[model samples]
Target: MFDFTPNPTFGPLQNPDLKVPTAAMDAQPETIIVGAVIDAISEQRLPAGAKLGEQALSVLFNCNRANVRRALAALEAKHVVELRPNRGAFVAAPSADEAREIFQARRAIERTIARQAVKRIDADGIARLKASIAAENLARSRRDKPAELRSSQNFHMLLAELAGNRVLQRFLAELTMRSTLILGMYAREGHSCAHCDDHTGIVDALIARDEALVLDLTDRHLRRLEAELDFERPVAVTVSLKDQIFGS
Candidate 1:
């Protein structure tokens, strides 16, 4: 289950609703734990390389260490969390090469998605894209990084959905989650990775049903975002695991 809340300063932020009923948590503790960790990672609250201790997580999620271990194993299988021998689990940190590869994969996949989206997007689809852009703009104006990043990801995922390709949508979902970690580590400070104008232009071309133009814009926008990352200067921001997951 998920819940979204509107922020007074920006627009609505779609953070995971962590307040699960005890019954549900007891039934699916691993699912709840995995979701909370992913949400935190996507939002940059759980920075790359942040330690996810079993004891702390078990306490925070009101579960046992076994459930936390299973959840960590699930996250590791998804490639979003890394488990080390005797060291426990930490958020996955992509190297410079891995980061470039992820973006390259995104460009290839998203261009195809944009082409299909142009062919299939209707009035409702365009409205959704525009709404996402508006929310992104509000987040940028307020410097709400997490919300802005979430909005950007949602826009791309929406395009994938409109493309009507389940396989590509699933692939893009994984790539986007991986990109969040890359961005958290390498994106330059004070830079908007997904510029609002670029998204608007893509939407414009989609409205015109210009497949070639959409493809060009999508490629260029992704390249620009990739260029904004400083591979040589990885930023190491740490957050208290419990605090970031729950609250300060």
Candidate 2:
């Protein structure tokens, strides 16, 4: 499993006092549990290969162990967590090969999504992409790496939405999270490619309604992101998942 260290951009990892009120707390315990895990992973509250103890999550969420297990099962289904018999669940740390495959899948799917989006491109879509880029720029200006990363993810999610294909959107969501883990694992020394200025180029092409350029831009954009992965660098230092999430 790839490891993750404390990213200054992600802020302090331990947030035991962190409390998020969930409406799902009432009718859907699993929903809350799943949301917590995904949020932690997306927000860097949980690093790659972090442990996810049923007892701790049950206590933290005031849910039952069965519910915790059920939630972890769902996360496992989404490739967000791994369940190891006799060991319990941990945040997934996809292998180098898996990471490459995820990117390859993304390139294939995103290329198709790009073509679909070009046909549906509109003024509103262009506006939204700019807005997302603006948010990314603001976060960068503030030097908030985590926020910038979220904004970057949002830009791609926006594309998935514009693709007009819910199935592809759902599939891309999984790929996006997997890609997040991959990037976190093989992150570069700097944020040049990670910042995603190429997204603007994509939007510009979309605004021009150039299908061919959109395809090239999106493929190149994803390729740039994939290129940022550095197998030569060291994996990050990891910690126990229970301790990481709950400060035990």
Candidate 3:
């Protein structure tokens, strides 16, 4: 929040404008498409298993089909979308086994991340994490599910940033995306956005540099999130791409 370090590498977060471009844009057209789709999916605006038609995306993004393909490729690498051989891309829907593996990976990698982050996080990083929690709280109050999801994701990403490992950060990005995809597909009805108390405890432990406590809280936090998912249930297939992408 206040005078905290800024994150220049926040992916899937940069704004996306779907309207036809009347002039050359500052960012690459592919970046715009990728960010837009990621934001939509991360915010749960794009539900799991929703198809992402390249033609429609190109039309809406005011770019050629080639640009849309590149964007989808980027999303595919991140495990956000599954690109089929004959069929086009769709929002990822991880299998139940894949889901467990994802959480298991998060538990392993995030524990190491938490250890590193608590060691290196300065006062500024702590403050920013606190600010992120506050922002998440506000998003919750406003009943903004999309914003809440974004803030919740941001909170975790902030920890990854504090860990000072770009490789782990990048790996977690893919895993987190896939984990959310699984949750979107199989999470029980009325399961709300992630609880913040665990995050708060983690931040406290990190601030205190209590390695054991930080590790414990981080593991518990992820396990709680995983427990919320119910693989027995499935999200109905959504055919309306517009409704899926924009929630309109």
Candidate achieving the largest lDDT = 1
Error of 2 at 217 (Å): 0.8
User: How would you order the candidates by lDDT, starting with the best?
Assistant: 1, 2, 3
* lDDT tens digits, residue span 1-248, model 1: 32323222111112335435212555688988887777677767767877787876776667899999999999999898889999878789889999999999999999889888988999999999999999989998898987888898889999999999999998998899889889878888776554669999999999999899999999999899888899877455344545447753
Q: Write the per-residue lDDT of candidate 3 for residues 162-221, one digit (tens) a residue.
A: 999999998887787677677777888888555687888888888789999999999989
lDDT of 3 at 167: 97
TM-score of 1: 0.84
Q: CA lDDT, every prediction?
A: 0.81, 0.79, 0.77
Residue 147's C-alpha lDDT in candidate 2? 74
lDDT of 1: 0.81
C-alpha positional error of residue 18 in candidate 2 after TM-score superposition, expressed in Å: 7.3
Residue by residue across 111-143, what tens digits does model 2's lDDT show? 999999999988898899999999999988998
Q: Estimate each model's TM-score.
A: 0.84, 0.85, 0.84
